[model samples]
Target chain A: MNRRDLALGKLRGLGNSIIDDVENNMVPSIKVPSRGTSNIVYDEAKRYYVLGDRYGKRSLGNVKQIKKVAQMVSMGNFCKGLVNTEKTATIREMYYVSEGWDVDFSNQDESNLIVEDLEVTMGISREDLGLMPEEDGASVYGDLTLKDDDVEINAIKSGKSGYSISPTIDEIEFLDHGVERVIAVETMGMFHRMVQEKAYKKFNCLIVGLKGQAARATRRFIKRTHDELGLPVYICNDGDPWGFHIAMVIMSGSAKLAHVNHELATPDAKFLGVTASDIINYDLPTDNLKDIDVLRLKELSKDPRYRDEFWQNEIKKMLKIGKKAEQQSFSKYGLEYVVEKYLPEKLDAM
Target chain B: MNRRDLALGKLRGLGNSIIDDVENNMVPSIKVPSRGTSNIVYDEAKRYYVLGDRYGKRSLGNVKQIKKVAQMVSMGNFCKGLVNTEKTATIREMYYVSEGWDVDFSNQDESNLIVEDLEVTMGISREDLGLMPEEDGASVYGDLTLKDDDVEINAIKSGKSGYSISPTIDEIEFLDHGVERVIAVETMGMFHRMVQEKAYKKFNCLIVGLKGQAARATRRFIKRTHDELGLPVYICNDGDPWGFHIAMVIMSGSAKLAHVNHELATPDAKFLGVTASDIINYDLPTDNLKDIDVLRLKELSKDPRYRDEFWQNEIKKMLKIGKKAEQQSFSKYGLEYVVEKYLPEKLDAM
Candidate 1:
């Protein structure tokens, strides 16, 4: 069966199971895998976070659980309808859609949780259930060709701005490309610089602009490019703890959404910096580390995802230097400096 | 001469005039049109804000003005190099690039002011000077065809996600499309819904997602679509002062960016909204107006942009209702209800 059909079956099965419980005069209950940090396990083998054996149950019998149970059932019905109709709604739309339900969500956050609950219980990604994110993924450029349905989009030929990654990335197939590696830059300015200078052609790679902490679709796209297309991924970001965390989120899965890490996390991705060391070596224009930066650096230093000697040393070095720099700081050399000198040097070392 | 040549000539001319002054042992100076609110005027003919007759001067002789004069000259030289090399830099990149110069910018805001200074003095858009904003423009999905250099992109055919507006919008030419009108949406959720439902095909119109306050390129794209392609423009946003203000920014122009309003504003664009009447007539799910929302409504009521009877009534009604609703609030009917019902009603009324 297709992914959509599989998702439909699971949603329907959940609804049927609840109906069966009602017919049998037993309390209908939904078992959701606990997504709390305590139940979140760092899977060393897969190099991503996963839910542990712990599970939570919401039942119709208890007043405390009744509302949640109704919400779960309503969401299941909604997902089934979406898959059946071949229509999709963003998580926000789903919240608004719930207003018509007898058991409606109090807010978007409550509805968002139910969607997560459905995902965990059904063992299906939200995309398969015909739900998408509101924000777009990322901007991509270079020689890569992506096929979505019958339409084929050659990123380089699309336009000077290239292609915006679809929110529902699962539907897109990496058709063909001459690129050997993927270099994801954090800032749009640096990304545009690379595109303008045709850094992809010079380095034989595709450039993905992460546009800040990447949306789930952006991470999925990067993961797919690395695994399905066999392109080694390298991330270039500002020399700061926040940048490191963003890179870490893509490398491992984000702790907040660890349930979908298998599809989103790219463990093999390498970090190409604006590293703390690079800030010192290149003599880039620097900003004094703010209090928040220091706090975040301390926090990441303890994070399991950034526990490696290299990351540990870098974090320490950054704390010692008491400064941070953006990727565009290389523009001090010239506009072409990042693509021509800094990038080539980093990639050569890799 | 072309725009690039025209811009280069202006920059060089300014430089030469300064050189001539210096050769004659006179202090070098540059006159910049004041961009403060007091120096801002509403042009009734153009229906957008324009700079007034007030001017500010920075000369090399005064110790207080030396830093700014040196910075302005350095920026002119930098812009000349960019034009000569056929390169582009973001306002942020220009600040970082300043690090290599004898007269470096202390902060990004200060550098941004210098770019504006050059723009005001030379009467040239920053795009002509090869300076671009870092933010990507809004996403567009429709039958519209855009020609960016040799690449021709049919928005509808691009992918389900559609096309991202290029930051440098001047280079893109609106080719052709089978669309009668353009609808710019404030939220991505509603935008995605319209795209998913093939609302463009159904209504015979193009849909542009503002993704919040419309970016300069997005506004420019909408303006081009309406003026060049003869498509009427309509804006759909939440029933709030902020949303109304965003619509105003697209239609009449933003006061903060008054200098570029000629290129960015669409005076003929109509507001098709989740207005106060719609909130009551449709009985949409709503949130009580926050203190800031009320304050904004009161402030907008006093502004000349919202001086029309329609806007005044809407603003007064919104304050009276003491509540606001999002575009997604229409999803209370169903997922497809927005594209199938609300939009058709609004478009018909227009």
Candidate 2:
């Protein structure tokens, strides 16, 4: 069955169970995997966060749980209607859609939590349930042809700006490509420069500009591209703690989104510079590390994600140097310095 | 000559005057149009802000002005290099690009001001000088086909997410389209629904999602499309004051960007919906007007941009009702209610 059909079947089963309980004169309850930090475990073998065996039961027998159960039921019904009609709604729209139901949400955050609850209960993604995010995804450029909802687009030839990774990237199929690796850059300035210089052509790689910490769809797109195409994923971000965190989230999994790490994280992905060594070795323009940056570095150094000798040493060196540099700092040499020199040198070493 | 040639000419003229002054032992001075509020005047005929004939002279002879003049010269040389090399730099990159130069900016803001000063002095845009913003522009979808750097993309057929209005939209050519009007929606949620339902096909219009306040490229793209294609531009936003301000900025130009309003503003564009009348007439789910919202409404009512009877009436009605609604609030009726009922009624009235 298609993802939507599977999600529909799960939704029907959930509804039938509750109805069966009511018919048998028993209290209706739903068991959800607890999503607390304590329940989130770092899986060493798989190299991403996975849920531990912890369950949170919500029953209609309790007065306080009645409203939440009602809200979940309303949301489930809304999702069913969306899947049945072959339409989709954003999280914001879902919140607004609840206004018409008997049990409405007080605010968007409350509604968002219930959606997460529903996801954990059904073991399905919100995308399969016909829900989507409001923001657009990454800016992808290269020789890859992406097929979205049956529409084929040549990423590089499409436009000067390249292809925008769609929010509904679950349906996007990587039809064909002529690339060796996928280099995901964090900043837009660096990404645009790479596109202008056609850096991907020289390296035989696809350039994915994350814009910042990537959106869910962007992470998923990168993960899918890596798994399906067998291309190595390299993350290029600023030489700082925050940048390291963003890279780690993509490589491993973030605590907040641990549930879906299997679908999002690219454990095999490599972190490319701006490393502390590169900062010192290249004599690039630098900024003084803030207190928060130092604190984050100390924290990351201890985290299991950065347990590797390279990451550990880099974190320690950064802390010792007390400096950080951005990807755009290479513009000091010239606009094409990063793509022509830094990237070529880094890639050759890799 | 093309824009790049024109910009180069202006840059050379500025350089020549300085060299000529030094040769003749005269004080090198650059005359810049004062961009203060006092010099920014609303053009009634043009329906946008225009710079008045107030000049600010900076001479190298003054001790305080030496650094400023040096910075301006450095910026001019940089722009010339960009134009001659046919390379573009983001304002952020421009800041870093100055590190090797004699006069480097302390921060991005100082560099941005110099670029603006260069624009006002040269009477040419940064785009003409091969400079771009760091952020990407709007998301557009519909029947329109855009030709960028000699590459054509059919917006609807391109991808599921549509065409991302390129950051360097100055180079994009709107070749041809079969659409009647362009509907610019302020929110992404509404725009996504419109795209999902093929609402543009039924209305014979192009849908441009602004994401919030539009970037300069988005406004330029819309203005160019309106001027070149003879398509009426309609703005659809929320029922609150902030939404009205966003629409007004697109239609009449904003104060901060008065210098480039001639190229950005779409004066003839109509505000289509989420007005006070829309909130009451359609009975949309709304939130109580915050203090800030009320204050903005009062300010807008006094502003000359909303002097029209329709806008003035809506402002007063919104204050009286003390309510505000988002475009997504229409989802309370059903997912299709907007494309089916509300939009058609609003379009008929227009």
The sequence of per-residue lDDT tens digits that candidate 1 reaches over residues B1-350 is 77788988998899998999999999888888889999898887888888889998888888999988888888889889988988889999999889888888788999999888888888888988989999989888889888887888999877777888888788788787888889989988888889888889898888888999888889988998888888899999988988999999999997777788888899999999989999998899999999999999999999888878999999999999999999988888987888898989988887
Per-residue CA lDDT of model 1 for A1-350, tens digit only, reads 87887997898889898989989999888888899989998888877788899998888788999888888888888888888887888888889888888999888888988888888998888888888888888889989888888889999877767788887788788888999999999989888899889898998889999999999889999999998999999999989988888898999997777788888999999999979999989998899999999999999899888878999999999999999999988888988888888999998998
Best by DockQ: 1
Comparing only chain A of model 2 with the true chain A, what is the TM-score? 0.97
| Shift in Å, residue A178, candidate 1 | 1.4
**lDDT for each candidate structure:** 0.88, 0.89
Clash pairs for candidate 1? none
Residue A141, candidate 2: alpha-carbon lDDT: 88
DockQ of 1: 0.80
Tens-place lDDT per residue, model 2, B186-241, is 88788889988888898999999998988888999999889999999999998899
Leading candidate by lDDT: 2
lDDT of 2 by residue, A72-189 (tens): 8889998999889878899999999898888999999999999999988888888888898888888888999978877889888767677888778877778899999999998888
**What does the lDDT come to for candidate 1?**
0.88
